[model samples]
Target: MIQKAQEFMNENHFADVSRVQCLLRKMMSKEYHGLIDQIKEYQDPHAIFNIHGGNNLIAPTASQAEQKLVEKPADEIKKDKE
Candidate 1:
């Protein structure tokens, strides 16, 4: 799954500093105790921002989120901005 996620990330045009734990949870295969450390080590505050939600974050390199976003309907895109 991590390999798949990395592939997904690579296609989106994000960066290494953006793969936060929140994003990882979306693809989680098991519980992670090191989530916080992972987020701080990755997520890009400038591009993705809001790495402080409780899940405590998100960021990426081509990111799975962006890859999913690429598949989103036009209306969904509008909703994300709002």
Candidate 2:
């Protein structure tokens, strides 16, 4: 399970903190079981959000639309995409 989480993190950039939490919930259970806290503490917030054009391929800061998207339910976002 840890391996799966690592892979998912590798593929997906942590732009929205809530999105990361949502993933942890889906991947594990109701709670991330300390995973979210660990990431926040260990990882650099700027790097996670890819604020600078570093070699690491992380996501950029969340735009206004993205902020709103995060506020919406996952189901609603999926529906909008469809």
Candidate 3:
């Protein structure tokens, strides 16, 4: 999971910081030492959106005209198509 997260950060140019948790345990882990860093972390509020994942992709909503088109009588729609 950490390696996956590392890749995500690398691709997105991000640095990880716990919302508030300290990394004392991680820092103590020799296995993670090479992957760890001590630095000031700041949040860019606008950067909260996803860049790669379509997770943030919003489905386009039907406009009032579109909704009306759907609600129109089939006969009326057929007449317009003619």
Question: Could you say which candidate leads in TM-score?
Answer: 2
Per-candidate TM-scores read 0.26, 0.28, 0.22
Residue 43's C-alpha lDDT in candidate 1? 22
lDDT of each: 0.42, 0.45, 0.37
Task: Give model 1's TM-score versus the native structure.
Answer: 0.26
lDDT of 3: 0.37
Error at 63, model 1, angstroms: 36
Model 1: runs farther than 4 Å from truth?
14-21, 26-82
Candidate 2 stretches with Cα past 4 Å from truth are 1-14, 30-32, 41-82
Q: In candidate 1, where is summed lDDT lowest over 10 consecutive residues?
A: 36-45
Residues 28-76, model 1: lDDT tens digits: 5444424323333222223333333345354434335532323555356
Q: Candidate 3 residues 4-79, lDDT tens each?
A: 4434443443455542124533434554443333222322223232323433333335333321213455356446
Query: Residue 82 deviation, candidate 3, in Å?
Result: 48
Residue range 1-82, candidate 2, lDDT tens digits:
4334444544465455466656776767434455443443123233233222343334345333333213555456446745
Give residue 71's error in model 2 in angstroms.
30
